[model samples]
Target: MEGMVVSTDAYASQVGLDVLQDGGNAVDAAIATGFALAVVNPEAGNLGGGGFMIVRNDEGGVFALDHREKAPLAATRDMFLDEEGNVTEASTVGHLSAGVPGTVAGLWEAYRRFGSLTWSRLLQPAIDLAAGFEVRERQVATLVAAQNGIRQFESG
Candidate 1:
């Protein structure tokens, strides 16, 4: 079957296409694309965040995966409130705002159920890109645009 991969980032799309060319199925390609996005499009994709995926098999069976981050068990409804009981930016910025990361688990589960390519094989492209890949002009612009927002955080 002929397959095409599309993503916001060119390098990520190419990684998915490479997986398909290497005899991988759509799920494999998607997995590769997800990893590649994390490396090349960190502004939008990262292991720190969560996402959802829905797959339809050739047999017409549909599978939905929910990998959204969940609030920590100890979190309370007013966790982001300050001593004055006023709302604070605690829940909107910094490490205090982060939920448990779910991307890795979600990707792993998707691979376990639907992936045909070896896990290592699916990851190598992203790894290579991470080790060294030319940053595109568009990516530079995106980073420049995000600098102000990123700088607002203590860790930034």
Candidate 2:
């Protein structure tokens, strides 16, 4: 009679559950979960990145969504390699490495097709979390690990 939600991050999972409790459908809860992740699990939340999703409705109908990021207009397949044909470090780091994000668009599409809640309503939890969610021990640990890893890539 109720609903359930799950995710890698506890806070994000809670947000999704809250959305469901608030009358959101699976797609709406998923969008809320994603936005919550951006605040609570930035390392992988990647608001500026893209991904894929597969959904199955209660009617036995299934849908596949390709939200994979598009390469920037200027990008070329060979861009990741240098003159020596070795993979260049630059190919995978910094702005040049990024592609056009599709996550938001994909989420919106899903919500449009299957959601029972308003888009703005789904976004509110994430907004609230960003405004005041306190940093927890696990989050701190993740941040430290992320910092250490990123520092290794710094040239100076």
Candidate 3:
């Protein structure tokens, strides 16, 4: 994707445009762009998010993939209940808030089926991002402002 390495807010759409301009397939672009968005916009597009995809080749061959995760085996209505049987907010923030994470699998299937690039190549972005991604001003300010409420996450 040329000149398509945009911010979290714009990577997906930009990547699709790049792919089309570069003579690549549509699904290829969507998959690349989608994964890029997830890595760049973790708070928004997460590994826990689920969605569906529809695809058609130049010859008009169509395929669809459902990438939704199922409920965890360990789940229960009271799983998030506190000692007083109340729904603790913490239970809705951390691990408990997490549902089945099928995003990786979804990305993997797309990359495997329609991707012209190697899986490793796509992942290099996320790896590099992790090692060097700068925190946005909004994120820093939000964290600082919410520190008192989310202290547990910051605590060791």
Candidate 4:
């Protein structure tokens, strides 16, 4: 509160600060902020990566979460390999490149421990955005340029 510069476009930083201002702990703020960012920028800030969290309590109890993601057990060494061991385009796109997700669980733990509001409260902003806004101009242009490819991908 004294002197901190929240980076622009970083919802986590702002959210953490907001939670602190409301007397909530670090975990509460991080969860709220992480959700906001993921919703606003799914193409980039995704729920795909794993993260660890460290916690400190009033009596100096320290807790840690090793929330990192590991490759699926069903995965084989040749999962992305072509017959010749080269990566196939199909392996890198569509369903293949998608990693296991942990964002939801992380957020859930944070909310459970530190959130005062309902889950509905955390999701309202995203709901409002989707139900009532225009795509950005840059996104519109990109879509227009690749309309055929995108259409085919979605339809496929």
Candidate 5:
């Protein structure tokens, strides 16, 4: 069977295609594409976030994977409220508002269930991209536009 991959970034799509061409199944291609996006499309793709995946095998078996981020055990409904009980920006920004990241676990689970390629093989493309890749004009613009927002936090 033939497979095709489309993503927001050309580099990510190419990574997926490379996986498919190298005898990887759809799940493996998706995993590679996702990791590549984390490096090449940071504005929308990130390892710190969670996502969902639905797979249908050639035998007509369907599976749903939910890898959504989970709130910390100590989180409260009013955790983002200020002293006056007004909503604060705390929930929308900073480390205190972050959820337990589930992307890696979710990807691993998907691979365990349906992937054919080795995990390291699927991750190599992303690793190469992260080590060094050309930054295009669009990416430069995006980084420039986001600099101020990213600079607001200490981690930036």
Candidate 6:
């Protein structure tokens, strides 16, 4: 392979490159790239989000890892509804709407089964990138968009 990476976010692609260059396999690159996404693309890549993973071993065995987040233990079908059964705004906004996170656990599970590099080593690229990133105009625009979304939920 020529070692090419294609990602919507450049930083994430770089993270993948770093992992692969470090002698890590695809699973390792995936884990590191996912972590880097969480830092560089927080709007959609936060740890609070969960996702699936598919891995194929050299022997051709394939495995799917389901890391999608689940509702909190305290959640219920009607928890966000009012007495009259109308959906409350709480059901879709603010902290109350958040589900339990599962990304880290899912990544760990996949790595344990299919990884070649140490987990800590794979994570270092993301951590270093996060520590060194300087906010740019694009990120400022993202913040403005996020602020508008937050304003929509604000009572005052």
Error of 5 at 32 (Å): 0.4
Task: Output the number of the TM-score-best candidate.
Answer: 5
Whole-model lDDT per candidate: 0.92, 0.84, 0.67, 0.61, 0.92, 0.85
Judge candidate 5 against the unseen true structure and give its global Cα lDDT, from 0 to 1. 0.92
Error of 5 at 59 (Å): 1.9
> Worst lDDT window (10 residues) for model 5?
147-156
C-alpha RMSD of candidate 3 = 4.2
- Write the residue-wise lDDT of candidate 4 on 4-122 in tens digits: 32422354356546655765555655665666555554544457876777877668988777666666778787888888989877666666665677767776776777566667656
lDDT of 5 at 27: 98
Writing each residue's lDDT as its tens digit, candidate 2 over 1-156 gives 277888778889998998888777788888899989988888788688887878899999999999988988888889889888999877677668878999889888888888888888988888898888778888798888789657876886
TM-scores of the candidates in the order shown: 0.90, 0.88, 0.65, 0.65, 0.92, 0.87
Q: Candidate 2 — which residues are off by over 4 angstroms?
A: 148-156
Say which prediction, candidate 1 or candidate 2, comes out ahead on lDDT: 1
What lDDT is reached at residue 89 by model 6? Answer: 87
Q: Which stretches of model 1 miss by more than 4 angstroms?
A: 82-86, 149-156
Global lDDT of model 2: 0.84
Candidate 1 differs from the real structure by a C-alpha RMSD in angstroms, to one decimal, of: 2.1
Candidate 1 residue-wise lDDT, 70-124, digit = tens = 9999999999998999989888878789999899899999999999999999999
Better of 3 and 6 by TM-score: 6
RMSD to native, candidate 5: 1.8
The residue pairs that clash in candidate 6, if any, are none
**What's every prediction's RMSD, in angstroms?**
2.1, 2.3, 4.2, 4.0, 1.8, 2.5
lDDT score of model 3? 0.67
